[model samples]
Target chain A: MTAQPQIELTNIDKHYGSFHALRDINLTIENGQFVALVGPSGCGKSTLLRSLAGLESISGGTMKIAGDVMNGVPPRKRDVAMVFQSYALYPHMSVLDNLTYSLRLKRRPKSEAEAAANEVAATTGLQKLLRRLPRELSGGQRQRVAMGRAIIRHPKAFLFDEPLSNLDAALRVHMRKEIRALHDRLRATSVYVTHDQIEAMTMADHVVVMREGVIEQQGAPLELYDRPANMFVAGFIGSPAMNFVDGTVDGSGTGARLALPDEPSIQIGKRLEPGRKITVGLRPEFLQLASGDEAALHLSVTTVESTGSTTYISSLGEPEIVVVVNGRTDVAAGDKIGLAIAPENVHAFDPETGKAI
Target chain B: MNRVISSFRDGKGFDIALVGAALLFLGIFAGLPLVYNVVMSFQAVDMFSLGTFARPFVGFDNYIAVFSEPIFWPVMRNTVVFVVASIGGQFVIGFGLALFFTLKFPGSTYLRGLFLVSWVMPGLVVGAIWNWILAGDFGVLNFALTGLGIIEDNIFWRSDTAFSLWAVIIANIWLGTSFNMILLSVGLASIPRDLYEAAALDGANGWQRFWTITLPMMRATIGAVISLGLIFTLQQFDLFAAITSGGPANSSNVAQYWAWDFSFRQYDFAKGATISVLMIALVMVASVIYVRSTRHEVRG
Candidate 1:
């Protein structure tokens, strides 16, 4: 949104002995942006977040925070705050003391520290529970205390490492919005790390999908959803992952024929070499049940699952196809069905590179 | 009968039986001797009454006489100094070693395990070894001290009245430091590593993290370690016997060694029991503190 970047990382690399944990990572985040680094476990999302916090030093890179080069700066000198997945609240200290620890460490006056703690506590809805120790609070309350401790510091950037992973499902959903709201209210630069793509899609203004320490794709939430750069991003970004079916370009060069038993042909929006091998990507929600004349592919139904509002139909064949239909459908197992999709909703990828075409 | 059998087979009766065995053993071996020592402190006992429980009631006469003895105040002062100094040295050095080991350089686990050697060695054997190291003329400590320019002379550690009690305290501290380090290492290890990360990100340097995070989290452990140190130091008699033998003119004499001397050598069983009764009272207070501390762990 602005010309000045708040955080910039260029040519970042990390190594633990012979293992390269992170490769040439280049990213720049603008001021007050809520960015989420999301991937599966062992993908180095959390490691990247920790590197930004200065908890783990980069093996080779130039890291800048607030326009200052911070390559060798220690975490305490970095002027950033982190909320751990374990909450990591001071277990022995009361809620008020936990919130005021940073202030007290600076040798601030007791009255000034308490006033700051009280203000943060009120903002976090922890006013009535200030005297209770961390062990006395429930999981959600401890989470709030962890956040309050971070908020009291007025840090330059807030780094969150899977902060909602410990909560129950309902509470995780609730805290997701709460954390995003807190980020908006403070307008603080935040870098959130989580393995759940839904949390990334729902909460972050910009989402960076990662795999094995490499950024596969990064853009606005809908931009990534509508146009993924690769198969990994296409499968990772959507709820019901995109389905890939092997296909070959038709003689017309603008249509493709699927490899199913019927060899049904569908229109593609681009021109390619005739008889070129490609992979067709179809989203579940975009596929529709078609009548005989407009049917592109015909398949037998394998199973039908419903959750009151949507019906999930799995087709019976090799390279299984799943279709999500809104409202209830009477589709049952062993029933034959026809499927169709518009040309624009369909995506194609090169079978070798797995990159979107 | 069926109900009783069933309780033992599938209920609380078996648990009670297991606990009852431990209580019975304690009653016979430990509790009886403690109660007998308290009782003997209140009665007049001689060689004729040594075999029997019955003795003439003295009504605090033994306590008053023992308190009035010429060596009593000096022995009490020596005991206090011995306990305080030994515990202080052990804790400070042990805590330093514990924090050092947490750096986890290569082979740290093996090196830390090696520190347990001093803790497992018999006290008398350790004291015997210290006796050689603490010899008047050819001692390693005196050599190091003089080499460091801390002292000029050999100092005659065992014979000099000023350093006689300190001689035993030095050995006792060496004997106890390893145990202190081991317990403290466990306490330090149990702390989550993320807490330090959180604190560092919250703008606490290493020193502030220790004072705020490490020290408060170690409350239960510190309480337990200090109280146990008190108990062990109060019961420390082997170092005195092996190193100084209460020295020339009773200079290094303490309560436990003095109690042994009165009971076995002087045959003044009443005075011995009186001194022991005082020690038992102190140890009881320490026991209460140890239990309370270990029970109330400040963990989330």
Candidate 2:
């Protein structure tokens, strides 16, 4: 939250032969911000991260780091370090050597490199494992070694390309917490890329949602969740992905009504032109089972999944809703359920263009 | 049980028959000759005394005579020198060439094709070509050297004892380098690009990366190339036969050519088989020791 931008990308364009990999992009990140780039695979998120690290060359436009132009700079000269998705640790070198490789390349004294390596290894909780080679270490240990190498350089920024994609589910959750804590302790400017939206929501100071080489929306995590600019962002940001139902707007002057297919009509807070095609977006968490005598849309339950804390009910109806209910809901497969959603929780978009209305 | 028997009777026998045929072919063409050579090495026979089942029983006498000959020891020494020097020079030069080709350059593909000419030519043709170039009087090399004022007189390259060994060594080196270059080049290409990028960020420059990353990663390739090169170089005969014919006081005579001389030229088959058996034993021992020492370095 400062006036100075730590990293700035202006009108950056990248191409692979005739294929445009990254279109014109302009972004400015402030100092010590943890920014996450989230998108589906082949969406150029990793490519953008590599461009920032100077691991890849941009076909056009300017990339600046801390007020200095970084175009045409080799990665070693860019003063930016990257943690690859594969962790890319040198198999032949021990963890200690891997951490101190850069310092040794700078021709620092052996004692100094070893001391610095020990310090970083201790910080990463790898002090006792310094003598182990990459193949001998577990996946989590190898990932820590990769991070330790990046941290030992004390670079201007850190770039991570899907750093935890190879870990098991439990380890991924643990590493995600560790990364957030490390970022907090060091306050380092970092740009991380992943295809996992949950990671982006939990870890980023700001999340950038991208699709098909374009940014759909970029904002604080809750800001994006509450006010997505487009249907794509609304559907991509939430888990059980925001349920979308095709409908048509009906109603006159001051208020509007959504005429859902084979389901109950819904009232809207905003006015809309009657007979226009539209879609309604609702999050699974916002939809729940209605109590006795409550006005709701009746749906036939198709399946029910219960975790310890919450139960999810999938149903067949006009809008085909998914409902997240509180724990201990008496819902089962092949049962009829009443679904209720508030107006404030409903999002409407133009059905023709998928843009938020 | 009936169903299982029916299934087996339906088709599995054909595959077994095909495999049996392959093994039979290998046994006749490969195994039989090796067995015959082992048995022949123990027989005392000459080319002039060719009679069915009437050869004298030599036991270890042929092997003893092979060790007793003064010429045999010198030829063995020469063979060792030729194999070691040629294979070493080929590996170094070929590896350098492979590394050079890995770099981005203009017209590199075409240049690589041009460099493969020596490897593609048959061994006899290569020997003939080098023989014409290294001839004593009108060889292109001496003519070029004299014309350039590098030498006042034409050097009889293949006629002199000192120069003949070097002449054959140079030809063998040229012939062997291309194989090494192709194998090592394939190895270099197979390494992931991300490893190099990671190494670069870790501060490894060209030389450090080459030693720590490239050399260790290509250990299997290097071992295979070197062992095969040694085996091929030890059996070299065409260059020596075409250029020196193991002459000039027999200074450049190698074990393979000496075996041929004993079997064909001197008509002493028993000593020839003995030399062949000794060469095979030496190669097998060297290969086993090398593989054992380097096995730990290679990843599965």
Question: How high is the TM-score of chain A in each model?
Answer: 0.98, 0.95
Top DockQ prediction, candidate number: 1
Question: What tens-digit string does per-residue lDDT give for candidate 1 at A273-315?
Answer: 9999999999999999997989888889999999999999998
- Two-chain DockQ for model 2: 0.42
Cα-based TM-score, every candidate: 0.98, 0.85
lDDT values for all models: 0.92, 0.85
* lDDT value, candidate 2, whole model: 0.85
In model 1, what are the clashing residue pairs, if there are any? none
For each prediction in turn, the share of the native Cα contacts (below 8 Å between chains A and B) that it retains comes to 0.90, 0.47
Candidate 2 docking quality: incorrect, acceptable, medium or high: acceptable
- Tens-digit lDDT string for candidate 2 (B33-63): 7776677789878655655546778799999
